[model samples]
Target: MRTTLNIEDDVLAETKVWARRQGLSAVQVVFRLLRFVLSGGMEQAETGSAVVAGFRRFQETSPKLVTNEQIDQLRDQVGL
Candidate 1:
């Protein structure tokens, strides 16, 4: 990929330093980090952990209203 990227000089320098520290090419470091983020793996793991940790916080909250059983609902009322 012989393309130009307009990146901030300081950030690019820092990325180069980190890449060197990891013994990975700058491109490899960028790609791996991007995959870890954009693949949804990172968010999914964080969300799952947060859900488990915070679920107890909602234990005291009550629903303001209630409706019929979802599975037995009359779909035609809402034109579903």
Candidate 2:
């Protein structure tokens, strides 16, 4: 699936910045954008809290700053 693209320099720079902020590679960000557009753009399905593996997911309530380092540390502790 590798191919060359003629993306503008400014757009590619912006995408790289955004990808760094999200802890993802530039290619991953591009694919996510493509999927989002192809799947009806902002018209999403029903919204609700989702449960995975018997655990209900919820938004974080802490107002503390959570850095990528902290996330990686936790992931390592849990052997993720």
Candidate 3:
């Protein structure tokens, strides 16, 4: 995965600092960080805990149906 990336100067400097702190090369730091983010590990890191049950309950519920009659009524009410 050798490719040229146009990273910002500030971000490059930060990565270098992080690499030194972790005793890793810049490439290793970048790949490890990318893996953590892409694998959804960043969510856990930000929350400081694992996801709880019943989280995002809306995702499990069915969506409401908007009838054409309701749409027409709304259009008329709004002078559309």
> Pick by lDDT: which candidate is best?
3
Better of 1 and 2 by TM-score: 2
lDDT of 2: 0.77
lDDT of each: 0.70, 0.77, 0.82
lDDT of 1 at 41: 56
The alpha-carbon deviation from the true structure for residue 48 of candidate 3, after best TM-score superposition, in angstroms, is 3.5
Superposed by TM-score, candidate 2 places the C-alpha of residue 39 at a distance from the truth, in angstroms, of 0.9
Q: For model 3, what is the alpha-carbon lDDT of residue 32? A: 96
TM-score of 2: 0.50
lDDT of 1 by residue, 1-80 (tens): 58877879897798899999999988888788789877665655655533443342243255565466653476766777
Q: Residue by residue across 1-80, what tens digits does model 3's lDDT show?
A: 57899999999999999999999999899999999987768766766665567242233256799999999999999999
As for candidate 1, its clashing pairs are: none
Candidate 3 or 1, higher TM-score: 3
* Candidate 2 lDDT tens digits, 1-80: 78998999999999999999999999999999889756645233222443445454444567589899999999999999
* Candidate of highest TM-score: 3
Answer with 2 or 3, whichever has the higher lDDT.
Answer: 3
Candidate 1, residue 68: how far the Cα is off, in Å:
22
